[model samples]
Target: MSRSTLWLLFAVLAVAARPAAAAFPADANPDPRSISVSGSAEIKVPPDEVLLSVGVESRAIVLADAKRTNDADVAKALAFLRASGVADKDVQTDYVNIEPRYPYDSGAKVVARLQPEFYVVRKSIGVRLTRVGAYEEVLAGLLANGAQYVHGIEFRTSQLRKHRDAARALAIRAAQEKADALASELGVRRGPVRSVSESYSGGWWRGGSGGWGNVGGGQAMQNVIQQTGDGGNGEDGTLAVGQISVNATVSASFAIE
Candidate 1:
């Protein structure tokens, strides 16, 4: 070959044979300098509000009579609630039910027949009490206003968002600290946070208040026994308020440094 052509060919060969750039250190190990860890945090907050369940029940041989009586009784209860500072929005109708009371068949060897039965109607309302102590006065008012059927009282918190946010922040901080500690133990420095999560709604209701129910004109003692059996330890002659409960739980993950 000519000298110039040979020189050009040699330069081209050298350019293409540059050792493949060292193949980027194939099978390169990680820094081996960091560790990962998870952490959790929890916070408990006192309940800030209470829930009251109250209502009235009425019965009569005629369905219309029963409904009218119930309507009057409920109106009275609502009036009492309104006067007791329960806002229109806060007072909610929880339930209304109407059922028939049947008569026993007293005929022997007779054709099957059904008799028109009396009607029993019940209506209930849920009252949200911001101040727990207000339960006493509220109960008195409800009783004075002809509240016949008081169902139950539940307690809860109104400032749920505040507690939840605080818990979450704490959880994140705890997780970051854990990650840092793990990294320190492994002789490495923390990098950047990769993820975080938390659960804030871990609360429960322990005990509650009590109220009354009217057993309209039947077996009073039997009715009272049945009611007590049904309500458990909540059998108070007048009204009782329940305690509120709030709980928060959080879990967080941070990148290992």
Candidate 2:
């Protein structure tokens, strides 16, 4: 054969001898040699903000009268919250609802329900206090100044994203350590990360139920007058500004070599 023809023949033979690439990627199959691990982290920090849910309810024979009384009480509550150093923008109405209340008597026979005797007007407001030092003061004044109900109060931090990121980092570090330990025990080396996922929780975890002091509802606020004092102190002891716990968990998988 001619020299150029021989070179062409060699190229053809080399190409034919080369291994063919697989149709599917290497990672398409389950990594039987990989190890999966989970890690979790928890951090406790003080809350910098306070959220108070306050409401006012009024009833009267006339719907207009009921609404007017409710508006007046809610207005007073708003003003009280603002005066307690809660900014105007932070104190706003959450909801307004009006319903008819019927009067019924339990009789021996036919118990005909009387027509609605009164209309009930209810309005609730939410206040976010950036200054936690005034949390108790705002809670106290809301009830003292016409606020008929205290739905609940929550302590949280406005810097939620910052704390959550910190927790995530810690969880990831823990996951890496765990994977390294497992791989070492198996006498294998860790390869590229196959998959990773994370979940986090924080803020408003400890919520009060029912109403203020976990008492039934708005009617219960009437009896809480003594408890909602400016001192933040109760018969037993002083207020406890507890810390909030933030947690993050991560699931990671790595291939073993």
Please, what is the whole-model Cα lDDT of each candidate in the order they appear? 0.61, 0.74
Clashing pairs in 1: 190-257, 191-257, 208-242, 209-240, 209-241, 209-242, 210-240
Residue 102, model 1: lDDT of 71
TM-score of 1: 0.61
User: Tens digit of lDDT per residue, candidate 2, span 54-105?
Assistant: 7777989999999988888888887777667677888778777888987666
Query: CA RMSD for every model?
Result: 9.3, 6.8
Q: How many clashes in each structure? A: 7, 0
- Over all chains combined, what TM-score does candidate 2 have? 0.76
lDDT of 1 at 25: 81
Taking all chains together, each candidate's TM-score versus the true structure is 0.61, 0.76
lDDT of 1 by residue, 78-175 (tens): 88888888889888877888988876677633333344468988877788877655655676677668675445555555666776677667666776
Q: Which stretches in model 1 have alpha-carbon errors above 4 Å?
A: 1-38, 103-113, 185-189, 202-247
User: Candidate 1: deviation at residue 246, Å?
Assistant: 4.7
